[model samples]
Target: MTENDKPAEAHEQDGTQLARENWERYQYCVSRGHRDYTRLASRLEGFYLGGGEQWSREDLEILHEQGRPAYEFNEVMPAINAAVGYQIHNRMDIAFRPRGGDATKELAEVRTKVAKQIADNCRLHWKETEVFGDGMIQQRGFFDVRMGYDDAVLGELSISVLDPLDVMPDPDAKSYDPKDWADVTVSKWLTLDEIEGQYGKDARLRAEGARALGDEDFGEGDDDGTSRNKFGWQDTGRYDAEYAGGGPRRLRVIDRQKRVLSQMQVAIFPGGDVRQLAGDEKPEVLEQLRANGAFITRRMMKRVRWIVSTCDALLHDTWSPYDRFTVVPFFPYFRRGKTRGMVDNAVGPQEALNKAVSQYVHIINTTANSGWAVEQDSLTNMTTEQLEEFGASTGLVVEYATGKRPPQKIQPNQVPAGVDRIIDRAAGTLKEVTVPDAMRGTQGPETSGIAIQSKQFAAQQGLAVPLDNLARTRAMVADWIDYAITKYYDSERVFRITKTDPLSGKEVEEELTINQWVPESGGYLNDMTSGEYDVVVTEQPMQVTFENGQFQQAMEMRGAGVRVPDSVVIRHSNLTDKHEIIQQMEAASATPPDPLAEAEAVLAQARARLAEAQAERARAEAVNKSIEGMFSSAQTATLVAQNPAIATAADGMWKSAGGIDKDAAPAIPSIDAPAVAPPEQNTNPLTPANPSVGMNAGIEGGQP
Candidate 1:
C-alpha cells in the first residue's frame, strides 16, 4: 500500500505483469516529472471525482487490488484472444469493455462485446474459415448474425459502464467482475480508410476521410491483386456482395451537414375549401389536410382555389418563404364586380386595359414568337367614344352609330343643272338653308349655288323669306332634279361640280312692271325727269293722245261740265311741209346720258383733288413746324444754316416774311450769327475784315 511498494498481485501472472507495465507506461508518459501530477494522475485513477464519486486513498487501493486478478489473467494470455467474443454493433461503431477491470482485459472485453453485438444485430448469412499452424487447430467461424434488431443491421457496439471494483479493491486475492455495461448499437461502422474511400467517391467530404476504413486501404493494386490494408474491421458482411468483392471497399457517407430538415411546414388549401376551426380546435387537423390551409379568408371557393393553386405551383420550384405565400388574390376581387383592381389606378377604364393588353400582345408578338391574342372583354363596359379611341390606338377605323338612320349620301356627278336655281328659289322664299361648312359642298355644289342665288334674290326683293318656302317651291317644281337624285341615290352623297359657267354669263335681263295702288300717299320716283310738249292750233285739225305711262295724270269734271277729251284736235290754216317737220322732230330727238357712269367719273375727280390737297397741306405744315422749331434750338438753326439747301430754303422764307429787319419784324435769333464784337479799326490795310479772326471766333463759339 505504500507509494513505492509494488502490488503483490503484479507478479501473479503474465496478465498482471502486462497490466502493471501498461499502467507504469501510462503514468510515465503523462507525468514527465511535472509538479501538477494531481490533475494528470486523476484520469488513470479510474474514477471521475466531480461527476459521481469522491476520491479516497483506501478505495483507490481497493480498486487497484481488484484489478490485479484480471490483470494477471491478461498478462498470461495472447492479445488476440481478448477479441474472441466481441462484435461490432450500433450507429456509432463502438464496442463494450471486458468483464474484468484489467486494462488489457478491458480492451479485449470491448472487442469481444462488439463482435457479439454485431453477430446478434446484423443479417450475416455467410461463413469463412482460417487455418493456423501446421494444421494443428482448424476453426470455421460464422459471424455477423442473420438476425437484426428493429430492422437495423448492427454495425458497432460500445460498452461505457464502469465496474465497482474499478473504484474500490479487496485486500485478498480474488477475481474481478464488472457489474454493468452500457451498450450502444451503431447502424454503421466506418474506419478511417473507409471514410477516406467515400471521400474519393465524393470529394466534397474529403476532410472526413480519416474516419473511414476503406479510404486507408485504397491505392494502386499490387502484383498479387492486393493493395495496402490500412484499416481493421470486426464485421463487414452486412453490405451487398458487389460492395464486398472489391479489394478495397467503399461505403457511401452521407453529408451530415446537408441533411437538414425544416421544422416548420406550410400547406396550401384551395380557397373556400379550407375548413373553418374555432380556437378550441386542434391545429393538427389543418396541418394534415391539403384542403384546410390558406392565408386569405375565402368568400368564394372557386376563385380562391384558383389563386391558391397558382401560388402553390409557383412556390413549388422556389425555396424561399417569400415566394410561398400569396399576399393578395391573383385575380382582383372587386366588391361590386367592377373591374377596378389594377396596380396603378391611373389606368382608369377597362378600355384602357384592352388597349394596354392589345399593345402588349402586339409588342410581344413582334419581339418574339409569342402567340398572344387580345380579348374583347378586356375592354368591357367601354362607351362608344372610348371604343373608338381604343380602336384608333391600334390603327383600326371605328364606326359609331347615333342610334338613328345613317346620313344620306350625295353623288358628285349627279348634281342637278337647276340646283342653283332651286337653291335660289328656296333660299329666297323659304330662308331654310342652315347647312354647315362640311355639309355645304358635300351635299351638292349646284344646290349650294342655288341656295346662294335664292338668298341674293330674296335680299334684292326686300322680302323676308321663310326657310321652308324655297325648299317647298324647289321640290314642287322638280327643280334640281339631278341634285335630288344624287342626294337620294348614292351611298356616300358627296357632290362636286365638274364644270360651271360664270354666274355673270348666266344673267338675263327682264323688264318687270309693278303697279302701286297708293291710298292718297303719293309716290315719287328717285331719279326721273319730266318732259313738256307745245302744240299749235291750225286750220287743219291736229289730234294728240296722252297716256299716264311716264307721269301721273288727273282728270277734272267740274259743275260746268268741262271735259278734257282723251284725244285733242287742232286745225291749221296755211299749207305746211309735214315731212320736213317730221324730219326736224326726228333730228331733235337725243339719247339720254348714263347717269351711273357720270357719277363714277365725278367721284374719281373729287378723290384725286382731295389727295393732292392733303399732300400739299402736309408739306406746308412740315415746313412751318421745322421753321418754328429752328428758333427754339440754336443747334438746329446752326445745323440748318450749315447745309446749302437748308440755308437757301431758310433765306427764301426770311425773304418771304419781308426780311429780318429789326424794326419791321420781330427779332428771330440766328444760331449761326456771329457774336457782335466791339468795333476794332483795322491796323493793317492787308488785313481786310480780319477773316481769320472771325473764323476763329466762329469755331470757338459754335453751338452744341
Candidate 2:
C-alpha cells in the first residue's frame, strides 16, 4: 500500500493497548499526585530541579507538540495496556482505526507520523524491561529522561505492565493477588486496604490470645488476702466447653504473699526490687548492708520489723523505755479553791480597819469644837444661856460665849427716836454730809442695805431692766445734749446780729437767725454775727451760653455779683445767619447731573491734568533752576526768554493763533528748539545709495 494510505504499525507490540492502559494510569497519577512538586524538588536534588519556574507559552506549545506524543506512546499507552490489556489492542482495528478502511487508515497514518515525529524531536526518552524475582514477575516501563527546561527535570514518567488475568479479581473471595502486587510496589510494601485488613486480623488474634492467657500470671489473690480473679471455683470437666468457660482461677495463700512482696518492692523502688531497700530505718539498713557487702538493702522488711518491735514495746513496758513522761496536773493553780483566811481574815480585816479609821476621823472633824465651826446663824440668834447649853451639848468646851445682839426693831408709821434727831442733825451737818446735787434733787431717799439685798435677789431670778425704756432714756439724753449745743450756738447774748446784705426797701429786721443753721439744714451759722450761712452748696451754679451755633455757661458765687452775657439771644441770631448761608450755598450747588458718572469722569480728567501739570511744571522748574545755577549768562538769558507765560504775554497778550506765532514764540530759551524746515524729497536713509560705500558712509547715510 502507498505510504499515505497504509495503516500505521504499532511501535511496541501492543501500542494501542499500551496507550489505553497508560492513559488510564496517567489519569490516575495526575489525579492522585500531591501538589508539592516545589517542596519535593527542594528536598530531592535529582527528581525535580527547577522549582517555582513557570513554563513559557512557547515552551508549553513545544512541549505539547513533542512531549505529548511520547507520553501517549511510552507512558500512557503502556499504562492503558497494563490496565485494559489485549482488549484495547483487539478493539483498535475496528473501534478506533481499521486496516484498509478510509477513516481508520487516515487516523492511523496521522498517529504514526505524530509518534515518530515526537520520538525524533523531543528531549525525553523511554525504556521498558521485565522484572522477575521472588515468586512474581512483571513488565515495568520508565522514561529515560524526563522532559525539562534548562536544569530542571520534571518527574519520571512510568507505568507497570501486569498480566491480563492479574488486573481483574474474583468478586466472592478477597483480592489477594492485587494486595500482594501492591505490597511489592508501594514504598511501605502495603496498600491501604491490605493494611486495614491486616490490622483488623491482628486485633482479633490479640483478643483471642489474651483470652487464652487470662490472669494466669497474677494468680488471683491480692495483698489484702482477697481473691484477685473474677472467675469463681468450679469443676472444669463437667462444665460445657464454651468459649466463656475458660478464665483465671483464684490464687493460693503463698501466691498472695508473693504478690504482697512484689507490691512492696514496687512501692519502695518503682525501677525494680534490686534498686531499693525494704525497711523503716532506711539509712541504717543501707549502711549495714554496705558494711556487710550487700548489693541492696531490704529497707521495707527492716521498716516492718521496726514497726512490729515498736508496737510490742508499747504493749509491754520493758526495761523502762523512756526516761520520763510529762505529767500535766488535772487542776492548775488559778483553778484551785482559795483558803478561807484569804477572803475573810487577811483582806477583810484590813478593809474593816481602814473603814473604821476613816469614820472616826470624819466624826472628830465634824464636831463643834474642831475650830472649823464659826458663830453662824444658830449661835447668833441664840440667848446666852441657850448658847451655853448648846456648847455643852455639842462638847464645845468654851470658857465664855460672846454672842451677837439682835438688831433694834423698827415700828410701823413711827420713825426711830434718833431718826428726827438724825434728820435735824443731818440738816445742820449738811456741811459734813456733803450731798451731791443730783442726789439731793432726787425725790426718794438713797437705797440702803435692804434695797441692795432686794436688787441682788431680783438679779438672781434673771430679772432685767427693760431695754426699750433704757434706749429711750439714752435717746432723750442725746437729744438734750444736742439741744444744749444748738441753743448755745444760737444764743444772741453771746453773738452779735449782723445782716450780710440788706434788702432794697426794708431794714434788716431780726438778723438772719443762727438757729436756722442746724445740721439738718446742712450749714453752720457765723458765731460772731449770728447769721445763717451755707456750709456746702453741693448744687453748683452753672451758666450756659448758646452762641454761634454753640452753647456755653459760667458759674459764680451766690453772694458775689456775676454778670453773664446774653449767649442764648446772640447764639439764636448767629444760628439764623448760618442757616441762611448754608441754605443759599445748598441752592447754588444742588444740580443733579448723573452725579456718580460725572464725578468719576471729572476725577479722571483732574488726575490727567494734575499729572500733565506736574510734568510740565517739573520740567520748567528744572530748566529754570539749571540755567540759574549755570556759569553762563547766555543760558540764564535764554531760560528767562523761554518762560511760556512771558512769551504769551510778550506784548501784554497771548498771540498764539495756531502754530508758531512770532509773538507767542520764545526769544531766548534755555534749551533752543531746533529750526523748522520743509521736508526733502527722495530721501532713502535706510538704504545704501551705492554699493561701494564703507560702513561709515553707510551709517551716515542711514541717519534720518
For every candidate structure, what is the RMSD over all alpha carbons to the true structure, in angstroms? 58.9, 62.2
lDDT of 2 by residue, 430-478 (tens): 2121222222222246666445434433332210121122222223222
Q: Runs in model 1 with CA error above 4 Å?
A: 1-200, 204-704
Measured on C-alpha atoms, candidate 2 has an lDDT of 0.27
Candidate number achieving the greatest TM-score relative to the actual structure: 1
lDDT of each prediction vs. the true structure? 0.27, 0.27
Q: What is the lDDT of residue 129 in candidate 1?
A: 11
Q: Estimate each model's TM-score.
A: 0.11, 0.10
Q: lDDT by residue for model 1 over 428-528, one digit each (tens)?
A: 32212122222122335556554654443333232112112222222211211211111112111121222222221122333211122235765311100
lDDT for residue 272 in candidate 2, whole number 0-100: 38
